[model samples]
Target: MAGRIIQVYGLWVWVAFAFFIFVLFNQSHSPLPHSSGKPSTVKERMMRAEKAWETSVTLRHEMANKHPGYPRIPLFPAQTLEAFGKYPYTIWDFFPPVYTCPHDIQRVGRLGDGGKWVCGMSLYENRPALPASKAGKRTKPGTVIYSFGVNGDSSFEAEMLARVPSAEIFAYDYTVASLGPQIAGPDSSRAYFKQVQLDRMDVLDRTPPFMSLQTLMKNNSHTYIDILKIDIEGAEYYSFDSFMDWCDRENAGEMPIGQIMIELHLTDDENLNFNRLLKWWERLEKFGMRPTWLEVNLLAVTLNPNKADPRCVEYVLVNHKDRKNIMRQES
Candidate 1:
């Protein structure tokens, strides 16, 4: 009887322990956290992760601000603001790395001075003098002044030239294939127009063929150009190269030009583009010219404020000696 009772108690204890273990296992394996039907902890986790990321970004920006030689915020020139206000572009997008100078003032000259103005022809009337009178000849009213790439329409070039009565204009454009009749007609005498390709590189190599500024100077027997305006669809790169080469030759006592007006195109990547621009500026400096005017454009679309177009600004360089003359005149 005692043995049977002990056996029965052992069986009961085993049954109770098994029941307890089963309950504990079920609690441990419950699907409350991961079930699709359960309340979402996932969204809460994601929100927390985003908050952490933003905090990290803020901390990094603060650290960068404290760091030496970090990129500084850029300023705009007064003329640029007046001409093109808050146009969605950042100067950081187009400016080259080494040319990272302040843009808030006239980089080429002091403000409120009668400096040689460059860009859209609004300020040309305020200049101290027009091109000097041609040597030995009495200044004639409305003498022919030939400009390239005017496309048969009167532009700032034509308007500014008109201010000087000694200029009868002849503007040329070869790229506009449809305007041959308008440019080459008998009715085009006061400002004769020609639809001729003025951007060809091969034409520069010819001796007396066509459209060589050197040849034109040779033909006219004139030493200096009064107002040579150039805005030839990024052709300024090669043209300026040639112009510098000519200047070098002139420094060696060969052909030389008087005044030059060129529109410079800069690249978009600040580091790469700035390096390239610095090389060009260094060359200009070697030839004794400095930046007199600069216009930076930030191409932005209405739908996207954060994004900007890459090709966005024009810089104007003039002779440093001329800049000094401007300063003297202003004083």
Candidate 2:
């Protein structure tokens, strides 16, 4: 009887061991918990890559908001965040850039301090070769470039026109009567200039006439801007404030700019407080502008010997929402 009981227990133990082995084998062959059980095709790989990119962008945004650079003295007090009760300060290197370009970038201006760092020369280069039959026919209008603060340098404008002669270039600067000799000679017809200051329409006691971006776009009948370059001294704060209000009121949620290359001047003034700077930057980001490139203005450093941090910084930002439309036209 004891032998019979022992044999029954041994048979049960052997059956349990076989079941465990089967379960382990199935687990080893099963898809990972985080992966879909689909064949890896080109489309699937691309989808996975896109998902990874989105995840990385979200992570970087969170990191930027959560961990700011080592705390420093605030640039402005809290009272200046809003203006005229309607416009508010949008908030910045305390604000790290989170945008990147995957295309081949090149410098588009003079080799010295006047040139701009541009991403993807597709707008100026890589035009589909014109067939022999259509070699002379005028192609569609090239990119539209609006540059503010042509203080006396037109190297950028000249090079752009040389590359794409059909391009429409408009420059504005209240300080200068005309563009530099590069574009101001007999060949200046390729570029247009206006002695206007980029400012709010309501500001009073302004000697030179000023116009907001919205007003200029309307007057010029420009529905889109391929590139908008601004180096308006330190007026960006107020200029952007007015522009943001106009955006909120007129264009719904989209900005009409494709790319922005600006030289931001941070002076030791109450207007450029740290909080205000961050708010201004945040506002631009809210409109889908992402900085793909940034460089400390070496000229600013060389010129301003007293300040530890130079007053000027250069930023090249792409408007993700509107760039595709402009890029499609260029292509």
Candidate 3:
């Protein structure tokens, strides 16, 4: 009887140890979405961000230093463990704090697959920062957006342009044969679409109309950008480097871009390309940026069918120190 009791106690201890390990692993590695406000503590995010970066590098490490990082947190208190186990799409049950801002994360369409969200930013920086004017073709201050990728699902761009009527968006996508913006709303004039690669120029165009971010800004007579969103398949990683190089050469220091929303694409062959992404995130940090929001694309699972893939995550970053630069530069 004594031996049997001891055996049972040992088994219980092992089970407890295993459960603890499981929790630790998920919190450390689970790619979680972000809510509003800043992360609670700095040290916590420093650790969480690093660990999170290791396994899956779909992140935007821009100007998120204000709030500490939240790791693969069991954010939803509403859903019980039993509820999560019972459903397939119950992954949304791990709810993070919902952010309300300049405009809420409005879903434009569920067209092909995945949810489309845009015009959504942190309320802290959601004011009408973009200067508007009564005079026609005003030159002093302007709000411009540069979108890099456009498949059929550019509803995110169209919706955002509609929300802020004063802002103009320049979208780039070499894959699309169409050369003009296809916005179907009142603010259609503010949006322009181009069939060019955001990453390359020499091959696509004769003069390369919209070759680089620097050239695009110069051509448009702008020094600072209000918002930049990139989803150019796998080229975002390279274009980001080119953009940084341009900033370093032109501005003498960091380029003041207000916000960035990028979708990172990892090759099916390579899971976590750490060294490259590590350096990329580090460069963004130098420019006073941090990751504000991150969400996984559950819709992507149906497309690829690879359970271990980490390609369809959208990351939002805030550039905290850009307003001054925009005000100081010649536009």
Which candidate ranks first by TM-score, i.e. highest?
2
**How do these models rank on lDDT, best leading?**
2, 3, 1
> What tens-digit string does per-residue lDDT give for candidate 3 at 135-156?
6344464467777767766666
C-alpha lDDT of residue 112 in model 2: 74
Greater-lDDT candidate between 1 and 2: 2
lDDT of 3 at 262: 74
Model 1 Cα lDDT, one tens digit per residue, 192-294: 4545444323364444223545545445555554445554556555556665676567646332422344544433335434335546655665554434345
Worst 10 residues of 2 by lDDT: 83-92
lDDT tens string, model 2, 1-331? 9999999999999999999999999999998877557555433533453454456556545534543341223332223445323222122334444455535467887887779987656655654333223654334435678999998988988877767655668899999999888875533655789888998774436667778887888888777887888998889888888888888888887888888899898875665665567668778878877777877777876776574445678898876556454433422
lDDT of 2: 0.70
Which regions of candidate 1 fall more than 4 Å away from where they truly are? 1-146, 168-170, 177-212, 251-260, 266-272, 297-306, 322-331
lDDT of 3 at 61: 25
lDDT of 3: 0.57
> What ranges in model 3 sit over 4 Å off?
1-141, 179-182, 200-210, 268-272, 325-331
Provide the overall lDDT of each model, using Cα atoms, as 2-decimal numbers: 0.43, 0.70, 0.57
